[model samples]
Target chain A: MELDLSVEIAGLKLKNPVMNASGTYDPLRYESLVDPNLLGAVVLKSLTLNPREGNPPPRIVEVACGIVNSIGIQNEGVEEFIKVKVPLLRKFKEATFIASVAGLTPNEFAEVVEALEGVDIFKAYEINTSCPNLEKGGVNCALDERCIQQVTKAVRGKTNKPVIVKLAPDVTDIVAIAKVAVDAGADALTIANTYRALVVDLKSRKPILHNVTGGLSGPAIKPITLRLVYEVVKALDVPVIASGGITSANDALEYLLVGAKAVQIGTMNFVRHDIMIKIIEGIKKFMVDEGIKDIKEFIGTLRT
Target chain B: MKLVECSVTHNLRVRPEYHILGLECGELGSIEPGQFITVSVDSVEMVLRRPFSIYRVFENRGVIEIFFKVVGKGTKALSELKEGMAVSVLGPLGKGFPLYEGVTAVLLSRGVGLASLALLGDKLKGLKSRVVTIASFKGRDADLASDNEYVKSFSDEVIVLYDEDRSSDVENVRYLLNKVKPDVVYTCGSKRLVRLLKELPYEAYVAWEERMGCAVGACRSCAVRTVAGYKLTCYDGPVFNVRDLIL
Candidate 1:
């Protein structure tokens, strides 16, 4: 029996449901280690209007089953991405390229999309409204329903390309926020970015990261994000892209069963560069064992 | 850089807190002087791989040496390994120090920062360049140079400094710098020492340290603030020119 791993999110067609979360996987860095073409899509690091220097040292720390990071979306900005990164990414023809954009204001978000208007390499745009590590404009936008709608609408007006609004898990009612994004014309929803967290060094009696606070990712956040994904997907009409603590095919399958159209791998990429291959193979093997011919049969098939 | 499982030849505790691990890895092709390896400890509790500088590489013998302090859970777990144990290693990763043959060089290493530059001293010696090493430790008990004979053979002169005697330490380093007036200087230490070394007149290269993820630069967790922009310590460098870095 042949298993179909293909998934269609928004308008772009993905070979599988597995993709990378922004800022976690750099294709340029891992291109030689793992074939980017093997993954369903590659989400580039979040970019701003201008190049950012990011936060100071001690940017990451490992806790029990998770890692806290305050990288602050350090990127070469949008213009540099178009000139340098886009050309490099264009070589990977098999993978759908989703450019992740971050901005301080709605107008800035539109400007970034305007700059990327006719570039054929990019299949869609991931408007990052929920990065907890940034000093401003990231988590703020996702928390307020008005700001989420404003950014989504602004980016939607700029490009005909599908827009996926990434939401923060820090909100009180993530379902309400998801509805706002869908109403504002978001083609899809990336349910839950890292949760805001802080780790204190016992000996030093101070924070581990220089920035004092960061976003937590990995197995620790999986259950929390899983619940959020289930709630948001149930409440909204737009496709939901689950991204939090997805390390294995079983983890990805859980999200798919709970109504996620696709899943993004983040922290686990650090454990092994070739992890995606293992996940893809695992997913195929699982479908065969379960006698499932198509992935959609299991997607959103969780028993209530 | 490729991932390979190497057998541990020796795991010696040179000091009470520090251990020097020796692995028999065959032909780890072309590891630069300042490059590092990320070591995986096969324990469920330890999820992140620990990054260690290549303290020494005996090419002919196919042995790679790493010096580490049992500071936390990861390193403490690594310290328990015995001979013949297979340890997963991802290596020759990150940018290394640039070697300029026939030029005078000063190597300043503080505490465990010595692990990064110990091999560079040997490389400079091979280049027929004048090399002076300043090894500083928190106290006499913390010094591991006595156990490792490689440090003595690598540099022309090795000066030991103690933090307990701090009043004359900076002056002594300055005195040596004035005497050598080398063409270039390289340092690896705490932020204070790096900041102090930055004030020196000559061109200097500093090996930076940070809490890293995906020591291969895939994860943007190990970023160093530079004058130009944020540079990945794992990719752009663990070794960066002092002038380019803001701190």
Candidate 2:
């Protein structure tokens, strides 16, 4: 029997539910390595209103089953992104592009969306309020109910396109934040970004990252993020996009079964460039073997 | 560029900590000097693939060599592998040293920094350019200089400096810079060395080493702050002109 991998989130049709996590996978860098068309979408690295230089050296370090990074949202400004990067991305006509925006204020968030409104290439806007590495407008905004509502409402007013609010996992009550985000007009939710973390160098007796702290991602955080997804999906009405330490199709399946409409591959893109292709194949194989006709049948099917 | 499954033909421990890993990759494509490969460690415990500079490439023999120090678990696991074992490698990554033809070139490196420049000296020599290679090491590990014969195979002259020898210090680098007055300078080493080279007026390119999440540009983890802005060492460079870089 033929299996269907197609999914729709906030009206955007995805070939499958596998997409690259924002800032983890750059389609431009891996154009030669893997076909972008194989996955559902490609999320560009987070862009801010102005060009950012990012943090200094020692930006990442590997732990037991994951990695921590203090990249600090390094990117060319939104104007350059619209003028230069968008045209380059247009060549990948078969792949869906999701523009991830990071801002220091509500006005800045709306400004980025307004600039991207004319670019037909971007199918969705992922407001990255949950990034823990930035000095300003990162997880701090995601922590406050007022900030979440303000950013969501501001971006909602600017673009008719789908707005997906990416939340951080460090909060005391994720459901409270999700309620405010949905109420403020978030079309969908990227259920949790990297967890805030620190790693001390045993030899130096100092922090490993130049920024001293960064966000953690990889298989180590999967169980924690999976539990968050399960909790948020059950409490919220909108579709949830799960991201954190997803390396394989089995990882994606766990999120799907727990109610994630899509799964974003992070940290693992560093392990292997062809991971997305392997994941897509694995998902298809799982579906066929299980006698499933539609992938939607598996969404939120976890039994208590 | 491509992920190829290579078999380890040789893994020789030249020094107590350093090993030269040779992989037999079939029809290995064009790999320029200063380019590197990210080797996937066999252990599930080490999640990140270790990046190593191309020490040597025997294109005709379908073999490539990497020089690495077993500083951590990833390289330690890599050193444990025997011959005929399959290893996944992604290469020839990052922007390599630019080809300087018909010009006098001076190469300066320290410790394992030589691993990145070993093939570069060969490439410069092939271009018929006058090449002078200077390597610096700690006092006791001066024996490492003699172990890498390839360093001398291609350079017109090779100088080894020891930290214990006061005469052959940073001041000597300045003396050599003035003495050579070469058209181009290529360097790879500690940040301290790079900072010293940054003050020089020559056209210099330095291969930077950073803790990388993705050896590709995606994660932006290997970022180096430059006058222009931040650039990924994994993407914009493992090599960059000294003028553009802040330090």
Candidate 3:
């Protein structure tokens, strides 16, 4: 028997249950490796209002089974993304393009969303108020309810497309931020961004990353991410797109069992360019072997 | 962008700190010097790719060799790769050193940067240019002869400069440069020596290493702005004219 693969988060229906996490995979760079049309949705790297060169060197450090990135949201800004990236992404047939935006201020966020008004390819806008990879105002915008509500309200007022707030796992109470975002008119929630972490080279007596602080992702943070996804799914009424530490289809299934509507694959993309495909295939195979039908039937099926 | 698993043919310790990893490229030998291939160690343990320069690629043998130091977890994992173990590698990319016949001189390097000149010396040799392999390091044993033998076969002379401090190594390099003055100069590593060469009257080419993304010139992360404006180090050069650089 064939297993169903269609999934929906908020009002958006995805053909499959897998997505390329924001800032993890670049389609233009690795298009030849995999068929972009086969993807459920492609979340582009974080875009700011103005072009950013990002942080200094040694931006990434590989740990024991994980990776840390302080890329600082290095992007080509909305104007360039709209001019260059969006056009190329729109050419792909089946993949839904979700543009992820990061800004220094709420107004900048709204401005970028506003600028994206008429451009047709994007299915949604991911408001990244919490990126541990950056040093400044991006994460600060989601630390408190006031900032989260304000930024969400500002962007929500400007765009007709669905806006999903990507939250930080580093926050004290993620549910509080999720409540604020839901109340402020967010369409969905991407719970638990990379947690701020570090690694020191004992010989050099200094941190490995050039920024000193970086966002940790991969298998190392899987447990924490599941807890966050579970907590948010229990607290908020909005859909939660689980991310952080998702590597395989079983990992994605684990997230779904815990209450994630869908899952995002990050650092794993660097190693195997077609991991998304493998995960998608693996999820289908699991469903077939387990005698399950539609993938959505198992969504949040985990019992306490 | 096709991801294919290839087997490691040779996995041996070239030195105390370095490993010589050879993989079967099999009819895939268009890579240039300074251009690196990204390798994946394991699907679960190491997620991100570790980039390794092309130490040498033999088209007839269908072999691609990489020389890497055990610096961190990724390198540590790579060092443990046994012969016949399957590993994934993305291909020959980035702009290599320009091949010009009758080029005056060549300067080799120490460390993994020796991989940066794998194809360069061959190109210079084909051009019938005089070359010098100046082995600069902090008291490394002379018995470590993997690619050194390949370089020696192509160069005209050899100079060994051993100093721990990089600035001191630059001064020592100046002493040798004065002795082997030539019409043109090319270097793989040693930015300090490259800077020192800029102060001299002779024209020199210094290959600079930078953090890269995509390595195909799209990310624009490895751009180094010189007097001639910004140029992507990955595509435009891992090599650049010494006088053209601002620093």
Candidate 4:
């Protein structure tokens, strides 16, 4: 039986249920080793209103089962990204391109969407209101209901394409923020971003990263993020894309079984560049072993 | 960039503090001096692959080497690997040192940094350039085995400095560099080296080292401060012009 790995996210049909998390994989680097078209989707690094230099040296530190990183959303400005990246992105005709948008203010968020609206390359806009490493500090959009709604509404007003609002995982109540985004205009939700965490270098007697704290992602946070996806999926009717500590297809399967429409591979890409392909292959083998014909049938089939 | 599994030929303790991990693989095509490779540890605890400069790439022998200090569990685990074992490797990563032929070049290195420059010696021999290597060590134990052999193969002159004599200090290094008056300089190992090279007026290059999540530029884990702005050490360079870097 041929496995139908097709899955939907806010009306877009993806060939597979697997896609890369924002800012993790750059296709240009390993052009020969891997192909982006093999992925269901590709989310580019978060783009701000202007080009950012990102954080200082030592942007990442490895921990037990995970890594803490504060890249400070380093990127070419939206204008430059469209100019330089759009043509390159067009190479992946099969994979859907998602523009991960980040800005300091809601106005900045709206302007980014407005600028990218005319660009024919991007299939969707991922409003990244969830980054914890910004100067404003933790959970800026998570706690502030008005800020979430405002950013979502502003972005929603500008583009006809689907808007995925990635929520910060450091919040006290993530469901509440998801509600606000959904109510305002988010077509779907990327359940959570990396959890806010810190690590100190014992030899140096100081924080490992210059930002002092960063978002943590890896297999370590999988269970915690799984629960987050579970709660959000139970409450919300909209599509939920999971992005956290997913290392293997089994981890991805857990999120899919818990009702996530698709999965995003992040830090694990560092361990092996072909991890996404390994995962997609893993998922295929799993479906064949489990006698599952279509992925949508297996998705959200949790016994609980 | 390619991922290939190579058999471990040897993991010899080349020095008291350093071990040279030698792997036999067929043709890792056209590797430059400062270009590096990342080795997968295959342990759950150490999730990320550890990066090492291509200390030596011998196409005739089908072997590539990495000289590393066993500071943490990852290196410790790698040091324990026996010969004939298979290991996954991603290679010819990052930028290497400048490859201009027939130019007089001086390699200024400190501590384990010489490992990054070890390959350049062989490359320069082919280029027929006058190469001078001035290496400084804190003590006798920190010195590498190759330092003894560099003169016969690549360098015209080999000067070894030690921290105990204070001869390895900045002022002495400055004097040595001025005396050689080479066409270009290449360096690695410590920030103090970069600080010294930063002030010098001559043309110089640095093979920087940073903790990287991905050997590819995508992860942006290895950001090096540059005069132009911040650049990803994994992508933009592990090799950069001395003038280009802010540090």
Best by DockQ: 4
DockQ of each: 0.59, 0.75, 0.43, 0.77
Task: Report the lDDT tens digits of candidate 3 across residue range A166-212.
Answer: 88887888888798899999999997788888989898999977789
lDDT on C-alpha atoms for all candidate structures: 0.85, 0.86, 0.77, 0.86
Ranking by DockQ: 4, 2, 1, 3
Tens-digit lDDT track for model 2 on B114-186?
8899899899889999988878788656445655678878888887788887545888888887798888888
Candidate 1 lDDT over A221-285, as tens digits, reads: 89999999999878777899999988788999999999999999888888766777778899999
- Which parts of model 3 have CA positions greater than 4 angstroms off? A131-139, B140-147, B164-168, B178-184, B198-247
Residue B18 lDDT (model 3): 79
Tens digit per residue, CA lDDT, model 3, B11-85: 878787778899986765476656677787675676667667787777788888888778777789888988898
Which has the greatest TM-score? 4
For model 4, how does the per-residue alpha-carbon lDDT over B1-247 read when each residue is reduced to its tens digit?
A: 7888999999989786689899997777878889999998973567889989988777899899898999998899899999999988998788788787898888888888888887897788789888888888898778663455743477787888889989899999999999988888899897888888879887888899888888788978899888888888888889998888886
Candidates in descending lDDT order: 2, 4, 1, 3
State the fnat of model 1. 0.64
User: Which scores higher on lDDT, 3 or 4?
Assistant: 4
Runs of candidate 1 with Cα error greater than 4 angstroms are A131-139, A202-205, B42-45, B165-168
lDDT of 4 by residue, A96-191 (tens): 788899888777888999998898878899988864424345546655777788889989989889999988887888888889999998999997
**Which pairs clash in the backbone of model 3?**
none
